[model samples]
Target: MALLAYRDKHILSAQQLRKLSEHKYSCFSASLLDPLLQPWWNWLVSQTPLWLAPNLITIVGLILNVVTTLILICYSPNGVEAPPRWTCLLCALGLFIYQSLDSIDGKQARRTNTSSPLGELFDHGCDSISTVFVALSACISCQLGHYPNWLFFQCFCAIALFYCAHWQTYVSGTMRFGRIDVTEAQFSIIAIHLVSAALGPEIWLTKIPIVGLSWNYTILVFITFGYTLNIINFLKMFTEGGSGKNGSSVAVSIASTSRNNEAKNNYETCMKT
Candidate 1:
């Protein structure tokens, strides 16, 4: 009976299916390293059964991230002592699993022929919360909590950068995850965790004499630069006539049009399959 209800819920009319098929619902993101990993991802997606729901995968990923975050918080470094270096490895394992699961959820949706705008929204919303968990865990793993208020700042920067990227996507009708995207960022975080496990978290806290910046701050600088570049890209799109509309009136029109079009396209695409 439950299976019957599930099937009924996803069933779509022919006209609705056609509209979905013609609509372009998927986001367009260019990541420098994605191509290299595509084959592995494809294989994993193929192995996932269509009976499983994509949102369930997303929830599982979120749960893993949440557990990691809780562990990091418990292990947060004190001025006198650091978390057991081995715990960093645990964090890394959780992050890797979270990223892998996150990647596959979309594939699951596509496989099940149940992709929809709501699914995209649900995926992205979970991503936002996951971003916070990742940032906090990374900061703690790196011993950045030793510096007062710095950990909060790191979390804020991570969330703000992600929000900025999404905002650009909304306005420009194009999604650019940046030259260095979330996937790359997650891998970098994983690497940091491994390094901390090997060399100790103090390694990240040590300041370079010449630059007067620690490893943590230096990474933050790079993140800031990437978000700044995202902003520039958005401005470029606007000045160069994004959405192919022009003049002062274009701003209002494009804003509403792009949003509606994106939602409509995603809805159609999801239902079409």
Candidate 2:
């Protein structure tokens, strides 16, 4: 009972609950691969039994993804050492499974007539955590930990971009995805894992012909460039503000503030009485 009370007091305010109840999910994805994978996702979701809950599917995928990645981490905690070749393959398969399951959960929810804001919240929460593991696992697969600074930057850059993606959504009332977005990144990481599994992690150390930089460093440069563009795009959206009146962002914060003020006023009136 105490734990429940504590959760009620700290987890969310009355104003937040109201906002959450009123919230609707809006997103735009220009991902190059989404349409390509739509048929597969549809078929997979169709095979899912009506009794299966979407949240359960999401959690199962997240668990598989994290567990498989953890197996690789156990072998190469520093990300510099290559785990067993088979672990890389396993990690790749885990990510693919996670991606597929994550994509279809919403479809299953809709199919079962159980779609809700809570489900979206749960899905995004899992994705955020999965992003960290995915990025770290990719770095290990590429043996980026050999360059400690690059490894740090790569992992943190992926995280920062992910945060900015949600922040942009908060400020604009819409989640936006560029042409080369999450799907492309996920597939790229899977390919990296496959290459490592096939040719060994040392393959990333091979120097490119004229550029002279190792394959790992060359790939890092390309990824950094992509991140830079994503940052620029996010900044542009923030500057443009939201679609709301007076170019306001989502009104949740504003509404919460107003409610707090009202509550304070009411309290003062009660004290005077």
TM of each candidate vs. truth: 0.76, 0.89
Deviating ranges (above 4 Å) for candidate 1: 1-24, 77-81, 209-212, 235-241, 247-273
Leading candidate by TM-score: 2
lDDT of 1 by residue, 1-273 (tens): 999999888999675565556544536667876877788778888887778899998999899888976876776744224677877888899898888888889888878889887788788899999998898888888777666576677778788877866665555555666557888889999998899899998888788888899887787787668667766765775466345445323336644676888799999999999
Residue-level lDDT of model 2, residues 1-273, one tens digit each, is 999999887898776777677778888999999999999999999999999999999999999999999999999999887789999999999999999999999999999988888989899999999999999999999989899998989989999999999888888988888899999999999999999999998899889999999999999999999999989988988777676556667765566567789999999999999
Clashes by residue pair, model 2: none
Report how far off residue 271 is in candidate 1 (Å): 36
Candidate 1, pairs of clashing residues: 20-268, 115-270
